[model samples]
Target: MSLGFAYAAGFVLATSTGMLTLLGSGEFPPWLWLALFAPSATAVMRARNRQAPGWLGTLIGGGALIYGTLVVQSQGASGVLIGSTSGLLGIFIARLVTRTTLKHDLQALMLSLLIVIAGAGMNSGVSYGISFVAYAVSVVWALVTRQLVEGAEREASLPFGATLEVTLARRDIVTPVFFAASAMVSLVVLLSTSFLFVLFPRVGLGSFKMAQNSGLPDSVSLRGSPMAGGSGAVVARVKGVSGTQIDRGLYLRAATYDRMTRDAFVRDSELVGLQRSEWARLAHHEDARQYDVFLQPVTDGHLLVLG
Candidate 1:
């Protein structure tokens, strides 16, 4: 159950962040970095000599640095720069705090700041701006609740379930507190997951929608005549035409669109009913063209054209 819970938590965290990125955030999607959790599982081993690999920590630190640099460069100097810089600096400060005399007291504060600020910086956007903070809080709350559960379990295991009589140390109390706190964290995760899913757009998987450009007014197809002194890509050539026969605007269809929505043009279904005869007539006309047609490699699906 513990392993299942951990894996589910990790997956949920990753998947939620990934969805948010698609919704137009600049943050490094958590789903892409969930592999970072592998090192965390080392705590479960519990063997006397078992320890997390130093390389794991180094990799995370290095990865964060590289990620910060990329975010700074891609977003321009002032876009996400302040947030990214703050996050990286926070991580450094957290590491220093962990190494000092006030380490125990400052650990949670540093860790919380590192996750909340860094995560927010990594994936900034209007809709998902607070996601990182929620995620950080959830994690901390879960840890606290888990600790509380462990202490409660230990006390309950005593003879006659003597937890009622047992006095808990501050450390012991903390674990149960964490366990209860996990309930609230779970709720937050559930809410965040729903928020992302409901708002994230569902775009066609293969088609890319280029941003609008008003400047490029003229367009030409591959079947259009070659430019002066330029060898154009041959999509088709007319044959069996007499010397005087001239071609006008020849129609070429590269893809078909059938379904139209308020915002999208979707692939038309080939399902036949009353439309069979109408479609057949069009197909017959297309087949009669004496054009030696060439087609570029395309998605492996049936292509249809309508005049």
Candidate 2:
């Protein structure tokens, strides 16, 4: 029960992010954000054992579905899809509150995934990326929590009590460490999968472009002027620095030219793998500055900033 609330809250956040991303991208109307309260209120009412009859939920859900379909015939398809998803979400919420099975939960999760996928397909902006990350983490956490407790909960069902009894782990099955460990695992999954996605060659998808567009040479020949073929467009965005730091400027070390001639310096074309690991002890200062860097897919070897 302790883990259940965490999972529920995370699930809500993931769904909210997906909805907001779609809304921000103009895929749906602004009022769609307010529709989240339907499921939320139903879940809370059920928790308090004061929920209305299942017929009420069905009526509302059916009405919503019919309205969304009418919307599809008259206007935007994106809005209709999202509206139908939200209606299904509420129906699943009712199922979850009224049953002891996992069918409804899985159905809701899938619908949430559909929303996120739609948003991703329509928008490649930072908001959609953030929505994806939040959805990924929440899905990971919810899966972990559900898998661990499903059997136990089924066995521990009661006749006169609620199925889920949620508390903040004051003296319960889940603790802060459990949440932290799940978050770390989610991070690992996100990083590994993202790296694999970027590293995979997508030549058929037409993602790769001519090196001249990136302002960098594809292979070193030392024949042409290295600086002559590049664009002056922005490649990356850095956050957490002040205006003063931006005014001072930054120097970037993008690549190394190990093989050089008198005419020009050359870098290796297929110089493969190198891996290194070391540990060092150093004095720490009270003040340290850290910032986040977001880079566009400009080159195989990404840009690096130096102090």
Candidate 3:
């Protein structure tokens, strides 16, 4: 029973991490909440011996994978979302196969790991970071409990209550000393990997161009009739002004075009490169002023900046 509780707690923590990551993306649909909660809900039902047929589980898993692939192809769904859905489907199938076995626990662990991977891709917020740490600790507890449960089941044909009671009393497995050692080991591994990552060299290699192409266009033509009209729709809103304002015109610049032809203005292809330090120096000049801006959704993905 203690082992089961640990497993349940770990599963919930890991699942919450995934959900928080998706929430951070700010693009997850409300309808997808059902998908997020389905596996846990099904697990609860199965716990009451209301297990669905194996074939039905297989069908659901296979169909979900197919549907996820189709969604990716048609709607250009995020890689993280696709991977998460795949992992969820795997868990669904595993849950149907066996709930009380070590194999099932391991399967759930792997799926939870997959969800964490997806979460890393989806968001890098502080909340996600905290949730990830919680998940790591929970996983350690889960793994320890799984080992204990499996060992006890193998050693005795006694009732589950007796086996679990014996297992819980084992000092080697359940002692504070063991948990502390495990935690320290996990911490060492984490810090070592992070240190290596910080020391690694980064290569940008035009990845920003790929990002520009994937979601929205990087540039939009401002040399059209839309620029000449005062009756256009509002693109952005500014707030937090307290004092009385004068009736001066406000100008927001997105990009500058150097060459103006008869029909349109074309952007210059020549690029000027600067080092990070140089940019930082330029930004901190005494004549410079800073403003914070909030933006609404723009169809063309062109951000309006001010000089």
In candidate 1, which residue ranges exceed 4 Å CA deviation? 1-26, 29-49, 70-76, 79-113, 118-137, 146-307
What digit string (tens of lDDT, one per residue) describes model 3 on residues 1-307? Answer: 3445544554555555545554555455565556566547655764565655677657766776776676677667465476456546445444534455568657766766766677677676786777677667667766776676677777666554456556644555455675677667667777776666656524232334443443434444443334323546665554533222211323344544544555665665533232233223212223544445464433232334432
- My TM-score estimates for the predictions, one after another, are 0.31, 0.53, 0.52
Best by TM-score: 2
- Model 2 per-residue lDDT at 226: 38
The true-versus-predicted C-alpha distance at residue 39 of model 3, in Å, is 6.0
Using lDDT as the measure, what is the rank order of every candidate, best first?
Answer: 2, 3, 1
Return whichever of 1 and 3 wins on lDDT.
3
Ranking by TM-score: 2, 3, 1
Candidate 1, residue 34: how far the Cα is off, in Å:
4.6
* C-alpha RMSD for every candidate: 17.0, 21.9, 18.4
| Residue 140 shift from truth in candidate 2, angstroms | 1.6
Where does candidate 1 clash, by residue pair?
27-122, 27-123, 144-178, 145-178, 145-179, 146-178, 146-179, 147-175, 148-175, 148-176
Q: CA shift at 189, candidate 3, in angstroms? A: 2.7
C-alpha-based local distance difference test score of model 2: 0.58
